[model samples]
Target: MISSCFVTAIQVLILFTLSSPCVRASTFTGSMFEVQISTKLPVKDWVKEAKKDSDPFSLWDPTCFKFVSAIKSVDNQLKEALYTCHSVPGGDENTRLKIYLFIPPERLAPEKQEPCLRAAYKKAFDDWKAGVSANFQIRPEQVQFSCELSV
Candidate 1:
């Protein structure tokens, strides 16, 4: 017994409530280094647990330590590296992973740090494979790195 106008109004309200999170505008301040990983492993969950979680420092284990250590060793003055990761959608593999490394300005510049960053990621990959089971292994070529300025 509801009128069409009432049904339309309710639908609009429901749509707005569901889409509000995506409608908000936010800015990222810092440099963003992307680590693109293509693998069959459950990288999405691993990244969510290791980097995207609120208390990653507490959740991280030796693999995280080795990864961060390798990144820090890229430069003596390098101090900050914040991470956020997500799985790329509609990929051919089990998952295509993107790890965002955010660092403040006047610290690490993308152009100057890319090569070292690649090496660091390679080392991290090796450490990760060594620590995990055979099923979780990823090859060196499966990981790629790129850097960009945060807008």
Candidate 2:
């Protein structure tokens, strides 16, 4: 029979080995902008409702060629946005949907170029909110933007 102390030591070793990758992964950092959407409905349902609308860019200011060109320029500069959703703690009957826009270190835009991208993102988000508000039971005011940059 295995001794209790031996079993405990083996468990500890397994745990340490299993956790090493997580520790190493945390050490690697990058630049990202996060947009959080707070809603009363399930996140998947909310997103589906939101996506039902036509593309925001196509609807927002199609008459202005300059604006469309600017948005396309901004889009070309950034990476694809990643989305994640989860339930809020404490049984609040709310969901938190996070959108992550990852900017590679080499592709990071200068300070002067940020406002254009931010405005485009904000408008797109606003359009989405307006389109999905009725179906998702969320208001435009509940979205929040946070930025994290690793220099």
Candidate 3:
């Protein structure tokens, strides 16, 4: 009887262990910087730049196109979009953007977190670089970006 009880206990423990959620370290990308769009420029111009012939609007996700559409509806002198992408080991952030693509944290494997985050930062940097380049005519390479990670 005791042996049977012990086996049941061990089985229960194994099941519990398997069912438990595993939490891992999370890192935030693009947390240290913000993309500022000049209000002086027309929103249509920005859309046009983003939707250049080489990069058609259709190439972007439908949600991204929606984001750009939403931007068109808003009227502000200076628009700022905070680009913060976090990689949570077992979870995801559902937020999306037209300019900066937010990569969910769950898509990245444990070993590939850093590289994936670096890629995300590069995307954010490139988006900002392109925006300023179109608006202010500044060199894309000259734009600066600083990324930060938080537990």
CA RMSD per model (angstroms):
15.7, 17.1, 19.1
What TM-score does prediction 2 earn? 0.36
Which ten contiguous residues of candidate 3 have the minimum total lDDT? 1-10
Candidate 3 structure quality by residue, lDDT tens digits, 7-121: 1101111111222387344333322222232222233555555565353442333333433444334443113443322211212222212222233333222344466554664
Give the number of the best model, judged by lDDT: 1
- lDDT by candidate, in order shown: 0.40, 0.35, 0.34
Q: Global CA lDDT of candidate 2, please? A: 0.35
Off by over 4 Å in 3: 1-30, 34-114, 147-151
Output the lDDT of residue 22, model 2. Answer: 54
Tens-digit lDDT string for candidate 1 (1-151): 0010011101111112222456543344444444444655553465556665454431443233334444444433333544534345644653443433334443343344566664664465444333322334556456555543232
lDDT of 2 by residue, 30-143 (tens): 333333446444434434544554654323222222122322333333323322112223355444432233333333343434656556645654554453443334575664
Candidate 3's displacement at residue 115, Å, is 2.5
> RMSD in angstroms, candidate 2?
17.1
Residue pairs with backbone atoms closer than 3 Å in model 3 (clashes): 87-105
